[model samples]
Target: MKSLTAGAEIDAWCTKCRMDLMHRIVAMVQSAPKRVICLTCNSEHNYRAPRTETTASGVHVRARNTGPKPSPAAARVTQKARAEKERADSWSSKTLGQAVDAFTRYAMDKSFREGELVLHSKFGEGYVDKVLEGAKISIMFRDGARTLAHRAN
Candidate 1:
């Protein structure tokens, strides 16, 4: 067995490419490779050893999973949808029954307080969730919360 270390090249199962390819070790755990980057595909992922099975003929064969697996893109889309729903729910709970005219137009020179409604030109309507130190405030908008400068000197 060859000595393994960070930056050493090794044969690893590339999850993205779904193949056994040469990889450069990027991270290590207790002298074992934890993460690697595929030299062929240029994709980085957790280090996985190539699976092999011994057949009845005593020959070593590469093992493969025949089951269907969820793709990374599909998981990302589902996560994005869930996050958007949560944001919409939060925005609705915070802004429910609030009059449009109650929102104060946002300006860097203007001071703001917590729970105050703000109308931003770019980020649309949002409410001041927290008044921070150093003329900063966390505002919750329809999309998400954003930190903005207020009462700038």
Candidate 2:
């Protein structure tokens, strides 16, 4: 067998592509391929040799259940949805407009309290999540969470 180096062609299982395809050796560890890229799919990952087995009919087949893992965004959305459900229970008493009226507009020259809602000229609307001693407040916006200056007055 010839020595393998970077860019050498090899067969690997692409987790994303979920198939045994030709791959280019990316990095070698102790004369063995450590990382590779699927030429057919353009996915890069650790080199994984495909597992082959024979069935009752004596046909060669690649193994199953070697696909990509679930993405983190799904878990994050699930957690965020659960938290929003909890927050909705507490906010159930107020309508959208009523909720908006409950919070004051955010102003750089104004002070704010924690858990209060604030309308920003640029960031739209958000709820004050926390208040720090350094004139800063963590606001939870629909887009995500952010921190802004407060109590400039």
Candidate maximizing lDDT: 1
The C-alpha local distance difference test score for the whole of candidate 2 amounts to 0.76
Give the poorly placed runs of model 2, Cα more than 4 Å off: 1-60, 64-95
Superposed by TM-score, candidate 1 places the C-alpha of residue 2 at a distance from the truth, in angstroms, of 49
lDDT values, one for every candidate: 0.87, 0.76
lDDT of 2 by residue, 1-153 (tens): 888999999878878888888899999999899999999988889998774421322342233534477679988999989988766654433224655577688887788887787788887777787887688988776565688888833
Evaluated against the true structure, the overall lDDT of model 1 is 0.87
User: Ten residues in a row with the worst lDDT in model 1?
Assistant: 53-62
Q: Candidate 1, residues 1-153: lDDT per residue as tens digits? A: 988999999988889988888999999999899999999999999998864321332342233434378899999999999988987887877777779898999998899999999999999988999899899999999878999999944
In candidate 2, how many Å is residue 40 off? 37
Cα error of candidate 1 at position 71, Å: 7.6
Error of 1 at 29 (Å): 55
Stretches off by above 4 angstroms in model 1 are: 1-63, 68-80
